[model samples]
Each structure stands twice: as C-alpha cells, then as structure tokens.
Target: MNTRPPAARQIVIGVVLLVVVAMIAFLGSLASMPHTDGWYAVAAKVDWSPPNSVFGPAWSILYFLIAVAGWMIWRNGWRENQPNAAQKTLTIYTVQLALNAIWTPIFFAGYPLIGEPAWWIALVVIIALILCVIWLAVSAWKWSKPASLLMIPYVLWLVFASSLNAGVIALN
Candidate 1:
C-alpha cells in the first residue's frame, strides 16, 4: 500500500503479515497430522529418513522462512509503480502455498483412503510445488535477494521430502 505509514507502523504491518502467513501454514500442518499415524506409521521408509521427531521443528523453521520470503517479495512488488508485478507475485505465492497445504493430506490421508494412487497424486503435487518454489525464488531474486535466499532451505527440505515420498513408493 505504500501509503507510507511511519516506519514503525510499517514494520508492525510487516510483522503481522508474516505472522499470519506462518500461522496459516502451521494450521495446514494440523490437518495432515491426524492423517499421519494411520498409514504413515506403518509405511516403509528409506534408511536415510529422519526420525518422525524431526519434522515439526524443521517445518516450523521452514514456514517462518517462507513467510518472511513471501513478505519481502510482496512488499517489494507493492511499490507504487509495480502493481502488476505485485499481482503476479501474489499469484505465485498463493499457488505454492496451496500446493504445500494439500501435499501432506494427499500423501498421508490419500494413501489410507485410496491406496497407491494417493502416493502418485502426492508425487505430482510435490513436483508442482517444487516448481512453484523455484518460480517464487526466481521472482524473489529479482525483487529481493534476501527473499530468494530464504527459499534455499525450503528447496533443500522439499527435495529431501520428495525423496522420502519416492522411497515410500518404492519400498511399499
């Protein structure tokens, strides 16, 4: 909005926005959690798979990074002269977040309900997510280097997660 509130007020807005994004991501995770212990507990996994204990903290950190990254890019895009760019960036952010929110349920809930087809669907969803993440980073890099850099950890985590999904498919 660049209505240019005082710097302190602007910072408050940024903080609130980031917190809201992170909270939304966290809430989405809750949806997938109920689906986990069912089939996921018994699902075969790769030897390299980290313990179940690792996911919560890892995702928590990644969600914060993603939130800040999104805010940085969106903030940059919203400059007075850049409304069109802001719209495009917002679209990228929405698509990736939508994909992220759905993936776990597809992989975790879908398997128990639909069998192997669920994993396949999850795989497709993840690949799309990875693409969207890359798109977000590229767009972010153009607007803010810090924003793009924040995505690196997310990329690494998603790659590891993708392999885990693939491993389960092969093992089961």
Candidate 2:
C-alpha cells in the first residue's frame, strides 16, 4: 500500500499549488495594467472582439481551472516512485505559465511602439502561447486524463484569443 501522507495534507498541498499558480497569473495581469487601457482604447479591434470588461472574468475563471488542472497532474505524479513523468509534466506546465505571463505585456507594450511590425510579433507570440498550452495539455494527459480534459477550455480560449489577435492585426 502507498504510504503517502493523510488526505488533508495532500489537500493542503494542492491548495497551495493552486494559490501559487493563481498568484503568478494575477501578478502578470497586474503588471499589464499600466499599458492596457491606452492600447485597447486606440487599437483597431474587429467586430468580434470581446468587450474589454469580459477579459478579467474570463481570465479569472480560466486561471482557476488551469491551477486546478495543474494541481491534479502534480498530485498524480507525486505518487510515482520515479519522477521523470512528473518533471516533464511540470516543466510543460511551467512553460505555459511563463508564456501566459509574458503575452499581455508583449501585446500591450510592444505592439504600439513598433507599428505594423508589432502585429507580426504579436501573432508569433500568440501562436507560441497556443502551442505551449497545447503541449501542456498533451503532457497533462499522460499524467492525468482529467487534468488534460480540464485544459480544453483553456486551449479553446487561446484559439479565440488568437483569432482576436489576428483580427486586430488584420484590421489595423
């Protein structure tokens, strides 16, 4: 029989991990605040672009789901005697998180300053971000099926966000 700690301790660890992920996401959002409004206000957004107000709640829910999915994968991998799979899973998760954190600042700060070239850069970053999330989803599938399933919404959001990014580029 596995001799892991009590369920309560595992629960606490999962919650802590969730909080860490949430905080990272929250901090990234906070960092983008200074540049957000000005850029959005002036950007040539497409008709399908979501209202600015929609972003916060959408991101909040997505971040929460991301954290939970990551925690589930972590928990599943933690039980293994060898940690290779866990390490790979967590590395992919970390990469996606890093990509997520940087995207806002890149789009907000870099776009306006560079003019048309910025659109290409932004599109590249968005595509990279999408790929990273997809990689995370696949890695999570190996670690935990439910965790992989949980990432579907996040991937879908990234697709929609990519469309919005592309639309902005094309419109502008």
Candidate with top TM-score is 1
Segments of candidate 2 deviating more than 4 angstroms: 1-9, 80-85, 112-116
In candidate 2, what are the lDDT values of residues 108-151, reduced to their tens digit? 66665766676677678778888988888888887789989888
Consecutive 10-residue window with the lowest summed lDDT within model 1: 1-10
TM-score, prediction 2: 0.85
Measured on C-alpha atoms, candidate 2 has an lDDT of 0.78
Best by lDDT: 1
The number of clashing residue pairs in model 2 is 0
TM-scores of all predicted structures: 0.86, 0.85
Model 2: clashing residue pairs?
A: none
